[model samples]
Target chain A: MTQDSRTNSIVINGLNDSAFKVRLNRNLEIIQSVLANPTTVIGLVIVILMLMMALLAPVITEPNMPDPYQMPRDWQAARSAPLTPGHVLGTTNRGGDVYYGVVWGARTSLKLSLIVVCLTVVLGVTIGSIAGIVGGKVDEVLMRIVDVFLSIPELIFALAIAAILGPSFTNIILALVVVFWVKYARIMRAQVIRIKQRDYVDAARIMGDSKIQIYLKDILPNSFSPVMVQATLDMGNIVLVGATLSFIGLSEAGIAEWGVLVSEGQAGISAGRWWASTFPGLMVFLWALAFNLVGDGLRDVLDPRTETKR
Target chain B: MSSADKTILSVKNVKKHFPIKEGVFQKVVGQVHAVDGVNFDIKEGETVGLVGESGCGKTTIGRCVAGLEALTEGNIYFDLPSDKIALLEDSEKQDDKKVSAEQIEEIGNSYDIGKIEGDLFNHYRRNCQMVFQDSFASLSPRQLVSDIVSRPLRVHNVCPENEVIPRTINLLEQVGLGAQHLYRFPHQFSGGQRQRISIARALALDPKLIVLDEPTSALDVSVQAQILNLLHDLQKKRGLAYLFITHNLSVIRHMADKIVVMYLGKVVEAGNTEDIFANPQHPYTKALLAASPDLQSEVTSGMAALDGAIPDPARPPQGCSFRTRCPVAQPECGWEVDDVVRRLEHKDSIFNFLKEVDQSDAFNAKFTFETEAAANQLMAAMKSDDIPDAMKKMVSKLNCDAEHVTVSFKPAKTVPLIACGNGSSARCVLVNK
Candidate 1:
């Protein structure tokens, strides 16, 4: 009987080729939907440009050797104005180059957001998976802990933690890491809880797949889109929060950070040396706006309600 | 198409009760008796159709058979040898010659899906698979057709690494889908095509028993026939036993060799399909057959759709569970004080003034009313035509004292499934007589 059925089937040649084509088409469809929105395209372009600027920071401007992140001070160019010869966009009161600050500020912002987002996403997913899967007392206890973390306002919580750890760039990163992870934990827990009940997970269990296999293959992958969207949004949020913390004098003075440069430039605002503050501040606004637009577009595209359409 | 008398799965008085919890401390207030002492057997390569209305515990029984749920009571023996099955049945009968305890223990350790461990449990897992109702939800949205169908083989290492793809394509082909259908997500397929994929996945491991939990319920009628035909062809080729669960009697009549009718977590009737369809002994089964629209039947007004919803499974009525809605209910059909309360609770005027009920047992209870007039109203209601004649006849004692009305019923025992001579059983007083 099996032989008869096999003979009846029209076996196509180049099985792998067809399989590859199907996968490619599915991926292309996802990409097309994600790029359909105009706002998302604008966000994508700005994000790419910002990323390029960050990557080429050292190549675009000579590094301040020994400590590249430390702004180079030139007493001769002190308080220079916009488009001044050899000092475009002028310099701060202490002669920190505005052009250098703007370029390097992207690198700083990217580092802070990427590191915090990565660490927090991993931490949050781990805790949330444990809570959702283990449930019972562990779920109850972990959710209470998450609720405590969520109760406090995000910015103030990051500020207090950074303050307690003392003023430094590393400490601000640590504070943001601590503050941002709880939301991921909350989102992942909810997602895991929802996905674990899906019939495929039950089917996997019925097939005698190991618990870890079910979690990694069935639950995690299905539950990950929302987390992906959250991570993208947090790429913007983490920087905004970190910059705010830095602007409040939590970070060391004169670092090549956007928030520190904005603070330094604010002091000279009354004296008409606006280029110092304006350039780096504009970079911060663009960074946050680009990611926000992209995140909103992603939320619309990857929304679970519409996920089946693809 | 069934093989010689070999039992593939035997569900012996299985019960699954889920706890209803409340409050921060998660207190167990009560239990919903989802599957209460249900028993049936599926022979090798036979289809046992479990037919019931929605929430009749058909799906729960299916889940238990697939080993997806832990049974709160009783055992499900999977792939038990014929000799061991006979011994187990004899032991259950408790005849003069009893099977030894050690032999029973041996059979349980080897055959019971719940008690078996390690290699034996894995063997059971490989042999039993499930195809769920919602095709869209059952197949993983993230998985391609190749991954979904090939998953069981990979999990069980049923074949070598290199042969997984060929074997997957073969499985897909057997389900009427070719290799071109592989590598696509579940969302890309039509409902019937998705169901075909699900069947292909279930067929991957070449399971001995497949639990079809309303597998074609979500498909269009035309698509449903195609899937059912595909299932029949696959079964014929593979010699697979199926626990076919569905509420559609017409579908069951087409697919099942034997049928088990259930009502409120208990089997109301069980027999060969032709016998049950020709002469349904249980009232619920009769009502179901009457309600189903048969094309050959000339009288449309003959439809006897059951009135009243199924009673709460948490507090299932005594005796026959179907007695609440049985048109042919008798005096001995176990009418109790709860029945009186259920009938009169809808009358707001009488119940609003009713304060409490002090009950000694299900058969007896004393009603305390806010006024003597309210107690008289309750007494009048019980004797009125609003109450069934059988229920009124079963009331052994009824009296209205100033502000209290006392009612007592002849205590009825829980009805057991009685054999009716020709390889059939029914849970009804009329059948027993």
Candidate 2:
């Protein structure tokens, strides 16, 4: 019923007849080995908790709903101190609750990162796969474009695009994908280049697959690992990138973004209200740290070379 | 149904030459003749062995036959009647632009290689497949065995989606795997097991011709034996035609119905496997057999150790191509100034000491000798009895008139595979055609 026992049974079963169960054990070992690393474990837990908070923020918190078009403050409970008990994290200078702002901020930042990472992975995998698999002139042309994309500073470019696109959540995500996807494509393209040259790809060709089918069926599956690792790491990066964009006042009008919360908290910092920025800022660090930890764990687990230790 | 009418694939004078550049600016340079003028045929329900050294172009010819590579010259006619291809050729002579319509139509209509359109290409593709060398690298790491094997069936719409798993199970069973393998990934399988999975995937289409390119070279010997036996049994059951390409002579002996001996880019010898092994005609084929390890027989009898590695296909020996190493090279095996220079480069250090080379032809190169003695040494080496008596016999003219010595050697013709005095064909001068 549980994944742990399932893994145990596979390991045990694998020792006897030593057939397909052996293969299952191999994949299980990779998953376990990745999850076993302390940093990865910690990162995964952090990411999981952040995602849960984002999803269940409505159920766990009772924030007084303010009009979306208007500022989020009662204007009466403004600039209240911490440990107000029912107001737990206290109130913002705008009379909006600081704890509630953080809960909403976690949801926003997490959503933006998740959306941006997915888009980047998809786009990166697509372009990278094409460049790597279909070698020669097409590859030459695509790799040069990737080089140009990679040459530009991702955060600054993301800010510029977000500013021009006028800062809806969609626009920020689009900007993140536009700026960050080149890395995935570059990683994926290299993986694909290596994979496409592999004997399995040759076997696929000998099996009489068209060039397109070979890319989709043969090259695509193998290409997913590096991209998956990149995607998980990019989730952390998108959060940092997104927060920076919001921090610079380029966020959508009235959105409760983490960087926006940090700026609002900044205005109140002089008056001794620190909760405004600290919680939102801490959320960003925790999520980003979690992604890097998970990324390192995934590299060892997914890489074929590391199997010897396992 | 007749033996004469049953050839499944006919490779007629296939040639594939890859360009090689030496200096700068990437000028039009020498061509590394990968598959040069190779010819063979696989009859229905027969496995043909194509054996040679590493750069002998056996795999290149196989790739050409499988339609994986476009031939620079000549054509691979799969499942076409030799008589029909000959007739199409005669027609091609009359009309220069005649090849596209009638020739392709003849191949398509006769053997049904299928049309060039969507379903047609799929049909032809389904009929032919390949098994690669490296088991660890061939199967996709991300895919489960089920997905890898069942992919062809799904792509061709050979079976309904639900039936795909069942069909895949059937294929797996045929290859010694079972239901438990359905969800397992390739990494879970052993080297032998992964190769089985690759074979099962190849067999998914029920193909007529499976291009087995070193199917067992990467596996352990025992595993290779098992795979070879498996292939033999499967061939019997499916009545499949096989292009069994390998560098191992013993494998070809066991598995190949007919054997083709290739050297550089040419078929040096070809005929029934029985005739080839019993009486190898080409000198290269003889050297290859002598060098190959034979398990059933002990070594050091009449067996040969090849004098040296194969010459670069880019700059093959001009006359017999094997003249450089041919123990039985003749006065007309095409020895040239290069051969004399080649001899001096090895035996005379003075020729080796030349800082630069100026060439007049392959047989005549002007060497800038540092001293008169070295130039005379280069001239003296050309006329030496120390060189193989046969190669020395190939010298037509020798001139050491320059500090840059020039030697004009005999120009021998390329030895094409022709029918010998016996029923078999050989590409050697030893046997009269």
Candidate 3:
């Protein structure tokens, strides 16, 4: 409150500012180390390409054109092989442009995986934290339910649910979500059990934080890095599963999905018109691979063990 | 001291027994008596140091006071009304479990914190906070410095929405940290600075009592001094009652006005800091002071070390818990059969000869050794200088046959705390005698 005290405080702040700068520099160094890894760089490039494709999907396609899911058939240009103008990479037996299917499929694929991952994380984390923190009859009941769901093989469960719900985009998402949320829940429960014992959580309780507040604010945030890594890795797996389901005819038939695209061209593959299915199949593989690489990269950066190992 | 100095927290006969369960059924087998019948109080604007060895339950008592752990029995009254205290006393007398929820709610006029429900509990929680031993673990790594300090303010709704950051900055400055350190996470700061942040957070609620659980144990010596000074300055600035828990006597000597020395979950001695240090009637207190080397003490004064570890809290010695290692233990110190085993524990040759024991109680036991000579060896040692004369006098029965020896001490009363001087007490038979 006095001028002398104000000046004294300023001097103290000045002394600490240099130390603060050193810490900032160290943080930047860690970021620099992460970026320096070649795997992370390659992963970054592929991730950027896919992200751009997904983000620019609508602009790249003709919005007013009916049936934007697939290109219109061109009978005159049918069976055109790789590098053919206007229908680059080739034309399918159905005469739809392979490039169009690949481009728009990115949007559908990204959106589906993101929605599924988000739903699984929210549902799983909420349930898992509650089970772990409460730790009694409630924990026993919830965890046993998780165990039952976990015991059922993921694909089998997804197939049964999708079949019962019948084929639709929403139904497919619902099935995938039901199958995937268990993974997040189990991971989150384990994380919550560990973090809840941490001193900071105890401090929060002593600070008068309600049980809900402690879980949401204190325990959940500390457990985020692991959940984020798991989410990233699962995004790729979910997309692959979505594609597999569609290929097996568990998905809506008329969709811009990569798995559907491949199924449509499967008949042409035996007739020596390999471009029909090969290009679409290749797109699916590349999409999964790109996400996997990015996920791996993120893991290396986010995991404290990995950072310490370096 | 005037009547204005009110008691901020009063803990009476607090006990916390953690259930130790085993087997497939997970049935409760035993309980670790973590804080067994401890009592102390913190007056407003004063510091009371809870000094003890690691397993002595100082931290547990702190947690109980901070409302982090429920008391298994007894009461922790926080500025409770006289009528409410009377009601609690009635409930305590009548069968504590049968005390209805309505009674608890009615007694919520003032807090019997462990029993009070809803808003009363939250009020006690907000008014009493804890600063833990480990600063690194106590501050969440994911949170920035500003957010960590501002958390209490935001949780308690101490200020308006827009002023949270500014208030946090002000709190930080009071602890000698400032705007430059705001956005950085806990790991970025030095140990001292992080502890400062913890102090700042504790101060945020304008609490009446702060349970400082070894706030300096994890810090370097110089940093500890700085933090202690900061704490002192803050205490002076705002009339805050502190229950400062630590194992370091010198630190307690410097910071605390009243000192409570605990051993095996029980307070052995407690009094005003100056009086207790000047004349520690409890032998345990004397051993502790002598064990901790002080520069002020003569260099030729050899440190007096206690003989063994703290007894198991699950079954603490049935007498003065310190008697087995007490240098001045006497006949009336409640010598028991457990003491003979404890005495033989350090002498390898004597302990290795004996195998089995048939005991009726802690005070008597029949030992079956390998041969008669080994049994006679213990008897001879008991009379020799190896054992104390006072213990030898308490040996009312000692019989040795071909291979077994039965021994028993004259049953003595369990030592209780006796008043020694003005406001000073000790759990020693000598003081009582």
The best candidate in terms of TM-score: 1
* Candidate 1, A1-310: lDDT as tens digits: 7775464342433666777788798778877988999999999899999999999999998998888888989889899998899788899999999998888889999999999999999999999999999998899999999999999999999999999999999999999999999999999999999999988998999899999999999999989988989999899898899889989999988889999989988999998878888998888899999998889888998888887776
Error of 2 at B360 (Å): 5.1
Q: Each candidate's interface RMSD, rounded to one decimal?
A: 3.4, 6.9, 5.3
Question: Candidates 1 and 3: which is better by DockQ?
Answer: 1
TM-score of chain B of each: 0.97, 0.90, 0.89
From the highest lDDT down, the ranking of the candidates is 1, 3, 2
Per-structure clash totals for the candidates: 0, 4, 0
Please compute and give the TM-score of the first chain of candidate 1 against the native first chain: 0.94
Q: Which of the predicted structures, 2 or 3, would earn the higher TM-score when compared with the native?
A: 2
lDDT score of residue B162 within candidate 2: 49
- Model 1, B1-433: lDDT tens digits are 7766788899999999999988877789999999999999999999999999999999999999999899999999998888888788888876636788898889989999989999999999989999999998898898889999999999999987767888998999999898778878898889999999989888888899999999999999999999999999888988999999999988998999899999999999999998888777888888788788772263223447899999999888998788888888998889988888778778869888878889999989999999999998988899897799999888899988999999999989889998877788999999957
- TM-score for each predicted model, relative to the true structure: 0.96, 0.83, 0.81
Q: What lDDT would each prediction earn against the true structure? A: 0.90, 0.76, 0.81
- TM-score, candidate 3, is 0.81
All-Cα superposition RMSD per candidate: 2.9, 6.4, 6.1
Provide DockQ values for all models, in the order shown: 0.54, 0.29, 0.35
Q: Over 4 Å off in model 1, which ranges?
A: A1-13, B95-97, B295-303
